[model samples]
Target: MPSIDLQETGLRALNTTLQSVEQKDAAYTITNPMGAHAIACGLTHEINVTIEGHAGFYCAGMNQRANVTVKGHAGVGLAENMMSGTVRVTGNASQSAGATAHGGLLIIEGDASSRCGISMKGIDIVVGGSVGHMSGFMAQAGNLVICGDAGEALGDSIYEAVIYVQGTVESLGADCEEKPMDEEHIKSLTGLLALSGINAKAEAFKRYGSARTLYNFQPDNAGDY
Candidate 1:
């Protein structure tokens, strides 16, 4: 394991060192992040990285194979456009967490701000706490598991993606509606919860997804578009 202090090595140099490492299952510990932007973006190796403190915007964006753990809160766009592997935040996250991610598992142990998992593509996000408004907006695929409450306009214009909320929902977005959970949903949710290490019952959640009404354009529903 190697430790890099952001206050000493600088951001670019730290990223360069992490990116350049080709060893499999290599581990790194980053100290004194101090809310720096893009702390460990674009890491393709199957390494493990631990951030000692808070991370700023776009932390761990475009990550592939590498596993990133944030010990503190994360700023906006956490794990944006990630390809694969895991990104875990032990504390709260700002808006648009896991936005436009392709494939990966994002675990937020605390609350997430507005637009969490917005425009997500094939990413599986598990939020241990609540999420703000407009979450899962225009999500194309994957699953968003919210262990706590959800704000207004949840899953607006959602496509194919599934949302599971264990707590209260303020409102549903356009084309989004509550759906019955079947055995398949239960199985998936069980796996996700177990993988995220969240002690929540799958049966306690309510499933929500696209009603498929807005898949095509309709003149009578122009306001929704």
Candidate 2:
């Protein structure tokens, strides 16, 4: 594994190397991130990057086929708009973690702040700790697995996304409601937990999703609109 110190090589040179390289399975270790923003954005190759310390905003934005791990905390919008690849944060994450992501998995070993998966298209996020209010707002399609409690207005106006919470939810959003977890859902949750290396029981989770009542415009329910 090639190791680069961000303090010496700079973030621009690191990202440039990741983007320009055509190697199949390159591995890199980044040290002294010191909460640097946009550390590894727009990578398209199947590589592995390990950040030894805290990272600032958009640590691995728009990543594809790369597996990036942050050993410490992450700033806002971590893994934002990612297309594919895995970004794992060993520590807490700020607001809007995995926002509008289209594919792949994002794992936060610690808590996540507000709007955890806002407008997420097809990403899968596994949070080991609690999430702040308005999580999964306008989510299109994806799975958000929260091992801990959820704050107010969870899944506000969400669409087609599945949210699984092991702890209590303060409140549900406009079109969100608790749903039954069938065998398939249980199996899926189990798989996700295993993949994320979370040691929680799948049966302990409660699923929340759209009520489908707001799929079409209803004049009688215009107050919510």
Candidate 3:
């Protein structure tokens, strides 16, 4: 396990080094990946990469068959358009954590900002903390489970995506509604919480999502508006 000291090298050097590695074969233990941009883009192999600090935009964009773990906070678009494999952030994440993700699992141990899983596709996002407004907006296919509270207008303009919030929500988006907690949901949430290392009881969490009415269009059913 060779360590790539990010302090010694800058973002350009990091990109060059990652690009130069063999596809789906080489592994790296990158230290001080501090705010490096596009750390592992378009990877295609069973590569295991560990980033030991804060990462900037698009840290693992277009990833494929690569397991990348971030030990600290990440900037926007953490795993944009990820094709496969897993990307785990051990700390808090910024906006658009898993934007347009195609497939794979994204785990965030801390809070994630707005639009956590925007326009997602077949990607499973698990956030251990709260998420800002408009999370899961325009999400196509996948599951977003937030073990903490969710901000305003969650799951707006969603599509085939399921967002399970265990805490309070400021407001539900168009077509979004609170549903009855069933045994299946509880089972799924239990496993998910355990995987994310969250000790909270699954039964204590409440579920909310689109009512399937606002999926196609937004309707003003409320008189308050």
- lDDT of each candidate versus the true structure: 0.97, 0.95, 0.83
Q: Candidates 1 and 3: which is better by lDDT? A: 1
Count steric clashes of candidate 3. 3
Query: What would the per-residue lDDT of candidate 1 be over residues 1-225, giving only the tens digit for each residue?
Result: 899999999999999999998899999999999999999999999999999999999999999999999999999999999999999999999999999999999999999999999999999999999999999999999999999999999999999999999999999999999999999999999999999999999999999999999898899978866
Candidate 2 RMSD computed on C-alpha atoms after optimal superposition onto the true structure: 1.1
Ranking by lDDT: 1, 2, 3
lDDT of 2: 0.95
Least accurate 10 contiguous residues by lDDT in model 2? 17-26
- Per-residue lDDT over 1-225 for candidate 2, one digit per residue giving the tens place of the 0 to 100 score: 999999999989989987876788789999999999999899999999999999999999999889999999999999999999899999999999999999999999999999999999999999999999999999999899999999999999999999999999999999999999999999999999999999999999999999988788899977865
Q: Sort by TM-score, best first.
A: 1, 2, 3
RMSD of each: 1.2, 1.1, 3.3
In model 2, which runs have C-alpha deviations exceeding 4 angstroms?
Answer: 222-225
Question: Model 1 segments beyond 4 Å from truth?
Answer: 222-225
How high is each candidate's TM-score? Answer: 0.98, 0.97, 0.86
- What are the runs in model 3 whose C-alpha is more than 4 Å off? 7-26, 215-225
Instruction: Assess the local accuracy of residue 164 in candidate 2 as a C-alpha lDDT between 0 and 100.
Output: 99
Error of 1 at 107 (Å): 0.2
Candidate 2 has which clashing residue pairs, if any? Answer: none
